[model samples]
Target chain A: MAGLSDLRAGFDPATVKEDFTLLRNPHHDHPLVYLDSAASSQRPDSVLAAMDDYYCRSHANVHRGVYRLAEEATSLYEGARQKIGDFIGAPDPGREIIFTKNVTEALNLVAQSWGRANLRPGDAIVLTEIEHHANLVPWLMLASEIGFEIRYLRLGEDGELDLSRLEETVEGAKLVGVTMCSNVLGTLVPVSQIAQAAHAAGAVVVADGAQYVPHLPTDVSSLGADLMAFTGHKMLGPTGIGVLWGKAEILDAMPPFLGGGEMIKDVRLDGFIPNDLPWKFEAGTPPIAEAIGLGAAVDYLSGLGMAAIREHEITLLSYAMKKLEADHGDALVIHGPSRPERRGGVLSMQLDGVHAHDLSQVLDSRGVCVRAGHHCAKPLMRCLGLAATARASFYIYNDESDIDALSDALGEARSFFA
Target chain B: MPGLEDLYREIILDHYRNPRNAKELESPPALRAEGYNPLCGDEVVITLLVDEGRIQDIGIGGQGCSISRSSASLMTVSVKGKTLEEASAAIRSFKAMMSIHESSLAPAASQTETPTAAELAKMGELAALQGVVKFPVRIKCAVLAWNTLSECMAKATDAQP
Candidate 1:
């Protein structure tokens, strides 16, 4: 509901850039033009300060100690869970959120825990062709072990999911996994619609919100996801922290993914009873400082306003697409949905005469940081008939000037190769 | 802080544009091996015919970046007429120039052990890829072809009497 005018009034990239120390420092000759938020976003000073404050003042192993410092650490760690849950509109914050290494771990936890418990030899799980390796591999690994059928929804020419066979694919599927946004194509998928179809077919929907949660406003319940996975680092938080949010009953029913320390209620030599909802899944020592950092990132993002951030990115996407098309014409191709509103701020592009790696190398020399690889979505890359793509994904810190720098560098790269 | 000029030399670009032996040979007569830089999905397939302990023919296949394609071209040309041992020596020598010493476990060896001028003289046009040593990540691109060639050579010769 937030307008572009609100974006201009409140959110300013120039002002935001001042908060990141790395942005001020030049990579070589030019200041760092980071457009790789989809891989991982740059952290602001506030997130860094939060982590530092935690390490410096209140560092302790969470949940066990009766001391005030340990209690404080536990509170900070649990408080982060609450804020992140609220940020994503989880129905039950304390019980539904499970901390993992990253979204990859989070997805694997779901596949190992809920999937192993539910899946059988005759069962089938529906997945999309455009899922990142994180989403696809876990399910594939699980299916390979359990000998269940895996059906993939095909991709359309316009980079959207081919949902014509959605009903057929989900007909007897136990679970349906879908990415909310394509990291390579920047395509924004209609999760709610997919969820509706999946639900109608009596299938549970597991959403990959890695690319979506960072840029768009997310309400997991409204989105109709039974369970979801997203990472902290891609949303201006530190690495080593990820989140998996599921329905309370679903998480409660599932067995523990990993068992060692904090995950159990009582562990005898013979058997162990798992702990309550969230902690039941969190095994061993958790990333406490990283969680606090994520809390700060959530606070920062909330202050900026998710709607305004989305609007800012939309404006940036429109500008960049128009400029690139006008400048390069047929020589350059941008994948995914043509309409700016239909996609996120990610641009997966190819130059006619140059390979993506070479193009990215040239851009790197110009202090532009775009990812030039399969983007960890090799199946999607293979589907697109590309070995790799030079991806430039925008974040809240990026502006039109960064896009201009990209355009200029692309021109230079083309001529240099030519 | 190596510049783009260091990574993409004119010779390297020339080889990339007009690659040598960029084809696949028939499977019965030629042995094939493939290499992949999983980081970028850059793949190189090497097919070669071995006869009387010498490489008779070589072909390059698969798709990759300018560096990888060109390196494959250069590698195919360099080892086409050499014996298996000689070709492996060339690979070792090339890897050495890239500061990947096979024997040393010390991390400092890669940084400190620069290829000598004598070693560079023996490498010919392949020496141009010495700049890749300065950029650690692209060394995989430069060496991808050699690695595949080594594999193909091993399998081809092993299949013979």
Candidate 2:
């Protein structure tokens, strides 16, 4: 199996760390240790180079103009679709991929376009209490607009999705969409189980693979998802480029999201006709260079087997949780799921005394970075009885030693009040 | 590091271990205010015993960081017998000091926003936390209590003669 170091010429974590010249602060000489991969992944040199190469060589309008530049641009752009399709294990690249701005936009595209068209006044959109605002808001907007009832699957004591209540929540629902892995709770939902439930309810299942695809071997068929949306930035690619993959039959059934240049086959003065499959949803100038970078990121991630990445992250999470418990046992309250393998890689915690904002500040003072906020899941926050949590997430680059540093900082914070 | 200077400084730990005034006050005459940091959900309630124009007493109730809780504690202890106008002026001085006017710390500009009761309590010793301005991320922690004080004042004053 290919590993991280084998992917590149010299991908040494020690020697080839991120050269973030743009991310420097004046106070500290020590290298900033960033542990907030759930928020955004640091782009590797390869992703940057791939984008720079695309801009340098073939930078032209795709699907427009008959010249060689346009043809090349169109091929490269279409080629990214194939790459993304292959990366996510979608068989039909042509029908399976629609490039979006981000996961949020892709989810919104499904909600506004598909939900608006398919769901009527009485139809229901079943979601979980732990959904990020990206996945929840669009459906909410649709539900309010079209009068579709919204039901949420509650969480269990284990911080996992209450699979027992799945039928009750999703029964008679028109659509059931949920996250594969949580950004805050770090709990990994059973996508296959959810899909089975939704399918039994005669509802289409859309998976928020934003947190899943980056860490797991995501085969859309095996996962049984009708639609899946994810972002490039969180998976170590350039920002502003994301993917929305759906089953061909499902894609055919949904109405177009946006209309313009490339999403049409024929245009008349009266009304234009929709293009075939994926192109029907991808309107106007797509993020060409960012797509190329995402394709490169996919190559990089794939080269390092997703299983290995998952294993590494689980080990880090377990070690971090253990260390935190051992040291700050009396004071710290970790949110989401504690079981490492059950979750993805997010570790959101709140110290007993220190506010998350203050905790994040103290941690940042020591060059240990973490995200502290409501994390765009107000409903989840309410579920957990917390307004915000200080989150420290991990990825392939993060190791057990990083967890030690985090634990040390946290211990220091606890002792600061001792 | 109590013996050898740990990563967590002594002052910070002392503040966190024993939070000050973590309780509620009786209603009426107390300018009830709540300071909340929406970012972290650190909340503090402030109650002031304002007799005529003078501050008879002040106390706080809430949860938060060592800095926020400690600052609230210090504020309650510091602002006894100060007049409401004096307290309001002090709040103006503290806010200006913390926000932008650190170097000179004199009157840089007059008050633009109408401060509530909680906002008024944020003045005085609270101004000492001006160092938090340097860390933009932690600025909210420093102001969480102050904001609560302003809110308390606002709610109290709004219902007053």
Candidate 3:
């Protein structure tokens, strides 16, 4: 089998790992084998330096000051917006991209702004069972207030979304919310297909790209989503910055989400006019340094190439699955699509006779950082009959050696329990 | 940097492997309470029959990590057949023992101060759980059942009036 280390010299993780400072520093006895990138990726030196440089040179409140430093700060922040929108092939980068705290806030922005303005009592919205609480909770919160009905797209036994009744389920629904990738199972959903059906049924589609944008090549138009939400922290950028990309016409029709200084054009004693397309959604002084850091992150990923990153992850995933199955045999159960090509680089593992938390504790002792929990998707966990799962997710910095370490740790844990 | 040996003592593992009172009591005759560690999805359900002023029997249910499972098992054995006041005292002492390090950091203050020799003696087998404080995240797992039992006691007390 072609492992990550054996990949062509042009794209090498060993060289890529050097760019991240955290990987070089070992806080534990063992070297850090970070396999939790899906939670939050480690920032490269370029991204870190970009944020630091911005603070040192130009630290000013954006869009308000007429000073030179303020102009520079505003320029950097808006430049980031342009690049990020272009990253996902947004039609009009200036008008379509809205910055929020994180993906949760981004999703809430869509549901609160669009759903509140358009939806009424007895109107139906469709959400899949595998959606993160970020996607599900916002719609549920709106439905409660508006007295609308929320329908679910059930998950299949094979850990894929059951779209057999896609036409019937989304028939007259006003909106459809779905995740582009399962955070727990790593199963990639065909959003384009879902969007087609949702559009045919006169429903607008909102895709949660939190787990997908970091690991795959994304084109907003090709995705066919009216609006998409994704975070910077999970894609090699800092926390506190997220992107909400929407079609120009759709965003133009929506009302402002949060009311504050930047979101308004002119204020009166009684009422006020909302700002333009993107700023109307961005209420407060945004995360200036973090946005610059995210722009640097996009630059870093572009240099390395997203396609190469995906290929590297596929090599790692294929090797990991084979090695785990060969070494552990019936002792371990891997969730999601058996084929690596069909999924991202996330592996949620369950060891026989061992709880996910115990397994993660054991892995931690060996410096293998894996997430053990419902992964913010309790509905999906309940569907799988699992309280929790030990998830090991790969990114550009991971390789086959990390997989070996994980396998070796599993052996020790199994034997220790025995 | 305590090793796994500190967290996974043999006695704790034994209780985890063979949990005591891993069944639910009848609801009409028993008071029930549930606790959940939302971070890790570790849940512990407590059902106990409180008659007169004493706990007649106790039951443990739900699923969790080894630390939680064993802690629940140890809690049931520690409180069973004890008077209501005595069980409540055990709860206080156990919680005090859990937060011993936090209290020691302060200038010898409040009810949750470091346990005395007598209180330590009261902890008995439950003292094995002090290792949990080392891994702060797992502390919730160790205390889930204790907190649930506290709620159950509150329910039992409310029924008296």
DockQ of each: 0.88, 0.35, 0.80
Off by over 4 Å in 3: A1-6, B100-118
Candidate 3, A202-306: lDDT as tens digits = 999999999999988889978989999999999999999999999989999999999999999999999999999899998888999999999999999888888
Candidate 2's residue-wise lDDT over B1-161, tens digit each? 01113223444445456655555667675778776776566778788777776777777776666566776776665556777666665555655545634346445443333334565455434434545555555556666666667666666567667
**Residue-wise C-alpha lDDT for candidate 2, range A1-418, written one tens digit per residue:** 3335324422333422443332333326544667888999877778888888888998999888799988888888889889989988898997889899999999999998888789999888899888989999898887778887999888887788887878878899988989999888989988888889899989999889998888878888788889999999999889999899999988898989988988999999999999998889988888999998999888888776676677767666777888889988879888777678788889889888666766776677677889988888888887888867899988777655567778888877666543
Better of 1 and 2 by TM-score: 1
Where does model 2 exceed 4 Å of error? A1-27, A266-270, A326-331, A336-338, B1-21, B25-36, B44-62, B71-84, B100-124, B148-161
Candidate with top DockQ is 1
Per-residue alpha-carbon lDDT of model 1 for A1-418, expressed as tens digits? 2335435737788888889998988777788999999999999999999999999999999999999999999999999999999999998999998999999999999899889999999999999999999999998888888999999998986888998878888898989999999999999998988889899988889999999999999998799999999999999999999999999988889999998899999989899999998999998999999999999999999999999899888898998999999899999999999999999989999999899999999999998999999999999899889999999999988988888999999999989999
In model 1, which runs have C-alpha deviations exceeding 4 angstroms?
A: A1-9, B105-111
Ten consecutive residues with minimal summed lDDT in candidate 2 chain B?
B1-10
Candidate 1 per-residue lDDT, tens place, B99-118, comes to: 77667665874556777898
2 or 3, which is superior by DockQ? Answer: 3
TM-score of 3: 0.97
